[model samples]
Structure formats: structure tokens, C-alpha cells
Target: MGSKINDKRESLWQDRDVRFDVPLNELKLRNGERIVEYFSKIEDTKGNAGEEGKVTITNLRLIWQSKIKPRINLSVGLGCVSSLTNRTIHTKLRGKHEALYIMTKVNGTRYEFIFTQLDLELGTQFGIVQLISKVCRAYTSTKLFRDLKLRSAVITPNSKQLKVLSSETIYNKIDGVWNLSSDQGNLGTMHLTSVRVVWHANMNELFNISLPYIQISNIKVRESKFGVALVIESTDSSGGYVLGFRIDPSDRMNAVYSELINLFTIHSTKPDLGVDSYLEMGSSLAFNDHESNAALITTSDSDLKEIDDQHVAHQSDAIAAYLADEAQSKNNEIVYCPQLGLAIEKIKEGFTLESLWQVIPQG
Candidate 1:
């Protein structure tokens, strides 16, 4: 199931989940994605140790771009993250310093990333880590609002009350509803949360189901064996659970169905991932006063290329010099090959193909 689900969901993560050295246009926010916070001079120790960059925390993912070359960046989805912690690492730009270490799994491959704070004045290392941790926790805690759950315990057993979440708001509650899953339906109370719809049997509090807005492929009021019923068909990815509920008094049923439909539409347009980041300093970073927020973010990639150009340019020059020195020290010998059309440098005996790839940026 894990492999099949991962393979099926791979498209969702193909380009956006994990990316490196991508154009600025590619970093533009998705329909529902929002920037939570932004920090400058955050060095991706896992990528280029000497280069300082900006880190943008969003509801969906974490983005890091080099101040020198915005194209040199990384984006990791919140869904793919397995763990994150604070650790100390020695870097070329800064001598031993505390850094953010993140572990993630993408398409079955596990990866680790380290980010160090270069500017101590902006915020403490603990603050950044705690903020990210909170966001991730919120994302995990609110998965029920994004994914469909079958026969799940959405409410506390024996209590017959919904397990209210931090971001969840009960918009409506309807009593005397019948669950049409079986021939003799069970009476229950239906709950309308901000992002999901839930129903639990009054007799058996443990019998409950959760349907998130994202999973609702279709919703309609139609005739069933139990009379007029409101049916919700889930998306294929959610195992395609089709739930039905019957309510008396036609007017009340229509009102409830209309409300659900409206809420579902609103949620579909602007999804609530439930990940929020609060920073005392606000999210504004790396743009000039003359630049409008929407124009700077939505305009052509070139328009944002020169942000803090002077500072980044100086650092870029230094990095280029260091790379030049490193290359010279390698003592690569270019030789003409009979099998090949052009001259190629021979791989040194000590360096393997895997070792060579390690030097490449892995966001």
C-alpha cells in the first residue's frame, strides 16, 4: 500500500516537493501556498557552505535561495519531512555554529539537510527551529483535514464529542441524522468543521468517519433506499469512499447540503493546510520599497535577480575565487580519447562516481 500510494502521489511531489537551482518564476506561490516567514543570511550547509542565502517558510514547503545566485536554491515539502533537529556543524563561512538539520524522504529516497544562521542579530537559532517545528506539527496534526479517513476515531470514544483541533472551527452541527452505510441506519450527529465533515453513531461513539474537503470529489442530494440522502463521493486517491446520510424535513436537509457545498467550494479554492508561522518581525524581506509585493513576486524572474545585488555580488566573487583555487588543486589532466570525439579528464583512482555526485548541490 505504501509503495502504491507513493507511486500514485509522486506527481504531487515531482517538481515542487524537492527542487534545486531552479528559476525564480518556479518559486512563485501556488494557489493556496502562503509565505509564513522569511529570513536572510541563512547558509545551506548541506548545499554550498560558503554561500549565504534567504530562507522562506511557507505553509506547504521550505525554500532556500542563494543571495549570490537566486537560481541556486532548494525547496522541500512539509509532507515529505521525516524529522528536524538542532545541531552544530563547522562551515567555511562560519567556524563551528549551531544549525538546523532536517531529514526527509522523497520517492523512497532519504535525504538530510543542514541550514546555519549567518546573521545572529536577526533571530536566535532556537527561534527559527521552534517556529519550523510548530508548523510541521500543525501540518501533521491537521492531516485529517487534507486526507480522507475511513472508520477513523475523529471523536473521543465514550465521550461522543468531536476531538477539536487547534485550527478547527465547528461551523454547524445537525442532529437526528442517519448513516446509510447499512440497511438499518444508525442515528448520529453530524459535525461541520472548518475543513472536514464528521459523523459518529450516538449508540457506538467509536463508529465514526471523517471526510476532508480535499477528498470530496463530488457531493449531491439524491434518493436512496432510506429516502432523501446527501451523498459524498471521495477522490480516487482516498480509496473512493462514498458516504450517505439521511435527514428528515426536506428544508433542513437542503440547508445543510447547501452549507456543505458552499464550505467545500471555499475550501477547494483556498485550502487550509493548517500550518502557520508567527514571527515577531513579520515576513517582509529582500525587496525594495519601490517594488510592489505582487509585482516583485509575480513578475519576470529577471526583475528579482538583482535584489541586494551589491552584497551578493561581493560574496559571489569570493566563492568563484575559492572554486577556482579548488579546481587548480585537483590537478585534472585532459587527455584525447579514441572512443570519444573530444578530450576528457580521467577520473582519479580515489574518487568514485558517488563521491563526485556528493559535491553537487542536493538542496
Candidate 2:
């Protein structure tokens, strides 16, 4: 029966290729895996910073193919992705464009896919972001279900109540180095579920901590002397204490913050309120009055002569210089609400949690 079901799923996957121009072989899908969602005009962060492309999210991985000449291809395993969130970008002709940011677990590499040259209808980008988030959550849940072991065969009544929202193998920075050696920081698995966030050290199960969302008053990401860290402020019967966990690869920090915020909002008393205020906050952060200085591309006389000789050096140099400057500037600027940090602040300000659910696209 399982084999028959798998065959049916494969057939269904093949049938869904009516919209895609690329062949299935090019996608290189694994057995029983299928593409769930795809979008055009997706700009990759690599190379030109905004290289136009098409991105497809499958059960196994995200595959992106560049639309420009000398096509660039890349794929990221779903298991490696920490989070997917919506980002707003300012473009020269387009004014403002909504982009999808994919943060990975390794070295916190962030890939931005911008929706350019495409007319996005109302709520389109929101739907896309929500779909991506759901997919990531599903992958994380599946992984946790497989890896976490239990001693007893019988399940407790409360076992079903704990729904894993997100799980990842995170290294808790004890020392500055994450070498996985005995003297280095401990490595462990972290899970954010319906009730609380749990971290169990791989070396010792007893060395663990669980913090309920209700008790959490504040959660912030800041640059510390050790590096980027997630500081969770909570209050208990004994009083208040801050729990700090250093997440390496730094980029994955936002995703962790966003997941906690999402779970917290879901468990709030009133989940259907505060949509407008959250949108207002996001817009306020996105609005930048100062226009960025555009780069001037001037061709020297020798370069023009080289161009006549069909030499590509001049064009390559110009592109390389522009990209370097763009990267440097981005590194210098502070990211706004890297995760749902802003949303958490609004929640503390007495705003209800309605907007978050409304903004994120559901499966």
C-alpha cells in the first residue's frame, strides 16, 4: 500500500509541471519529492546582488535558476534552511519591492529573492511568504519527529498536545570557538513548540532548559562581546532572569527570533487583533526618505577601444566594483526587524497578535 501511494504521489508531481518551462530532469528531484510552490522574477542575492531568476520550493529543497545569460543554478536543502521571511527593498525605477529572504543554518548565509518586473496583485507576496514559512515548519517538524527518541512504548496523554513549530541543531557558544571539542561550546538540539522552547545538550540530557512563552516578557537580538546573541527576558515566581544563547552563523538568529514570536502570538489570548498596527510598523520601517546614490559607470578611452576589440574586461571590472560597493554598504547598514523582533515589541506595547497570522500565508 505504501509503494502504491508513493507511485500516485510521483504521478501527481509530474502532472503539476504544466506551469514550469524547465524539464523535470533539470530539477533533479529526489524520490517521492515534489515541487509545492514556484515563483518567477525571483532575484538571487549572489553575483549581481539581484540576479533575476525563478525559484521553486520542493519537498526536499529550493531550486533557483538565473534568468540572465550564462545561467546560474543553486539549490538549498529544506533541512538546512532556518527561516523564510518577507523583506522590503527599494529599487530605482520600482520604488519599493517586496523580497523573500531565506536564512540558512550554515554560516548564516542569507539568500534574498526579490520579485522584480512582475505585477504582484494584492496579498500575493504575503501568500508566498506564508507558504514558504509553512513548508519550512513542516520540514523541521518531520526532522524532530525522526531524531527525538523516547524510552517508553506507551505515549502520555499530554504528548499529543506539544506541537513542534520549529527545531534545529544549534551550538550553544560556551567559548568563542564552536570547534565541537570538549573545551569548546556544547552542541545541542533546540525545539520551539506550542508550549515552550527547549534546549537539550547533546553531551548531557540533564543540562537542558525550557522557557514558556507566557513567562517571556522580552526577546531581543543584539551584538554582544561574544557575538550576535538572542536574549530572552522572562519572569518567574522567584523573580526575573535573562537567558542568553549565542547562535553562530549569526544569520540564523533572526529566524529563531521569528519562530518564537510566531508561536507566542498563536498562544496569545486574542489572536485576531492587531493586524493593521503591525502592517503600519513594517511600512514605517520600510520607508526611507534618503535616496541611495546610484553608481556612475564611465568607460575610459582605452576601455572603449578594448570594447571595440571585443574584450569583456571593462564590463567585468565595472560590475565587480559595483557589487563590492553594494555589499560593503549593506554590511554597514543595520537590518530592520531581521526577524519578527518588531512584532514582539508591538505585542509588548499591548497590540494584539492578529496581524502576524494575517500577513503570513497559510498552506
Candidate 3:
């Protein structure tokens, strides 16, 4: 129960949000991070002419490194990326060709980067722009995993033909639903998408609520001034909103309520947080540091075995590296766990509650 989302901005930016001048040796997949796609023969237009670099799009961030000098690199987290666009910009590599423009804000400071396609044969059927756009969309849709949002524009604007999420499908829709948040309830259409329950005001589309099933603490039919209204209670982190809605025809309302309950139950079993990633059949998780093999290359069985061994060692190293960084930065403090209702140590990559318990001296 809170006011509509305002323009008040709050930042969660950290020192680790963006990194530059990264060493190529340090480029390894951390826990819960996977390479979605890789593009080579890409020119950093802002840099020198004919200076090509490789771009790796991961589940968490975008990494770009110079082909000739691997030490020159940039890593931008998706959390800080405000916009990604395709625009024609003048570059020494290719004159006035369409390039990928990324705008990001880290710690209240804005940064812009432009990268152009150097290899013409690497055309549009499956290009850098398309891949990055798809990955960015995947990240945006899966915000429930990161943080709680209220009255956000997470839904498609189309009212008639609602756009289904890549990992979600339409369940049902109820029209002529009245939201009882205001003194005079606003009539809107309620959509029961597989991922969330969305209700948008018919008059003002801006006034809407996208309650993801992950944040729903409870949903039941309750008696209110509107009489026989459906109530939804959100989790504490999500402002603990208790939303009420009314639908005409009592039986139909009951039916919709029952359907919602069933859908929530089914989704709870294996909830899709909207993260979609796919690596080709023979691709390796490791980044090939060789300049000659800048383009996408498939790995053989023998190569896979070698890569697996390296990956395990790299994962262990990565954990230690993160711990060292956390200690130096002094930012890894215990935070509140909304789900557990307790303040616990913030577990970094390659860590779990059980592992921490085993390591700690329990009295």
C-alpha cells in the first residue's frame, strides 16, 4: 500500500559495477555467469583506427578486449546500462557504418561506448546488435531476481494483443476489472501472464501494477466495500502492497481467482526468472585469448575436457579474488534477507549458506 512510483532515483552502484583496463588473464567465467554470445572483428570506434577487439556478451555483463593488446579491455555490467541503441556513427574502421551504441551510468557518472562491425561477412542474420539487444531484453525482464519494483512499466503497452515474454505465455485476461486503491476505483483490464499478474488502468495506461508471482505472498478472495473482491498481498521487500480488485459476475470472478491460484501453484514448482541463454553445441565456456581465433569457434571433445579442468581451477581462483576485492573495498557487509527475515553475511560468487556454515565455527 504505497503511492505510485515517482521519479525519485536511488542508486545501488558499486565499485565492481564497471571495470576498465582489465587484464586478459583475469577474463574467466565467475559463478552464475555464462557467456551468451561472442563477437569478434569488432572495432572500438572511439579508439584508434583499425584497432579491432572481441566482444563477449555474458548473462551478467558485456566484456570487450583489444585483439592486438589484450590488456586493453572494458567490462560493463547490465545493471548500469541505461540504454543500448544501433546508430550510424563515423568511425575510422568503417566510414559511417551502423554501430552499437551503449550508454551506461555507474555511480552517478555517465559513460558512452561505440563499437562497429569490422567484418562485413558477419552480417545481420545473426549480428552483434541483434544478440546484444536480445540479451539486454532478457536481463530487463528478469528484474525480480535482482530487486523488487512497484508500478513499473514491465508490461508491453499493447492492450488488445499483449506481448508475451520470451519465457512466458498468456494464461488468461479479465476485462472490466476495477482497482480499489483510490477513493474512486479505476476500471482496468487484468492480465494473468504466466510470469506475473498485470493490471493496467483503462483511462491512464501509466497507472498499472505488474505483480510478479515471485513477489506474491498471498492471494485470496476477500470481502471489501466493493463486495467479493480479489486481494493480493505482496512481499515485504516489494512494499507489502495489499491490492484489491473487483470483477462483475461472481462466478466468473471466482473462476478467474481459481485459475490464478492454480497458475501460481504451477509456477512455484519451477519459476522462470526470464533469463534465456543458449550456447552452440560445441562452444566452450572459456574465452579464447588468441587474436587469430577472434571469431566464434567450436571446441572439440579433447578441448572441452581441457577447458573443463581449467574452468574448475579458474572458479576457485575467482572466489578468492572476489573475497580479496571485498576485503580491500570493505563493502561486503551483512545485509537483510527478506525471505529468511534475518540479516546474514552477503554470500559472494561460488558460495552457499551450507558452505559458510561448515567453514564457520558453530557453537
Give the best candidate by lDDT.
1
For each candidate, what TM-score against the reference? 0.65, 0.36, 0.43
Tens digit of per-residue lDDT, candidate 3, span 16-87: 377665434345544335556677778766543467888877766787777665545667787777766666
lDDT value for model 3 = 0.63
Residue pairs in collision within model 1? none
Q: Model 2, 258: alpha-carbon shift in Å?
A: 46
Return the candidate ranking by TM-score, descending.
Answer: 1, 3, 2
TM-score of 2: 0.36
Error (Å) of candidate 1 at residue 362 is 27
Q: Which segments of candidate 2 are over 4 A away from where they belong?
A: 1-26, 49-51, 68-70, 107-117, 121-126, 144-363
Looking at candidate 2, the ten consecutive residues that score lowest on lDDT are 1-10
Candidate 2 per-residue lDDT over residues 104-194, each given as its tens digit: 5433333333333344653344355665676565555443222223222211234322233332222232322121223345666566755
Which candidate comes out best when scored by TM-score? 1
lDDT of 1 by residue, 158-188 (tens): 6667887656789998999999999899999
- Runs in model 1 deviating more than 4 A are 1-26, 92-94, 124-126, 157-159, 182-186, 223-228, 269-271, 277-299, 303-363
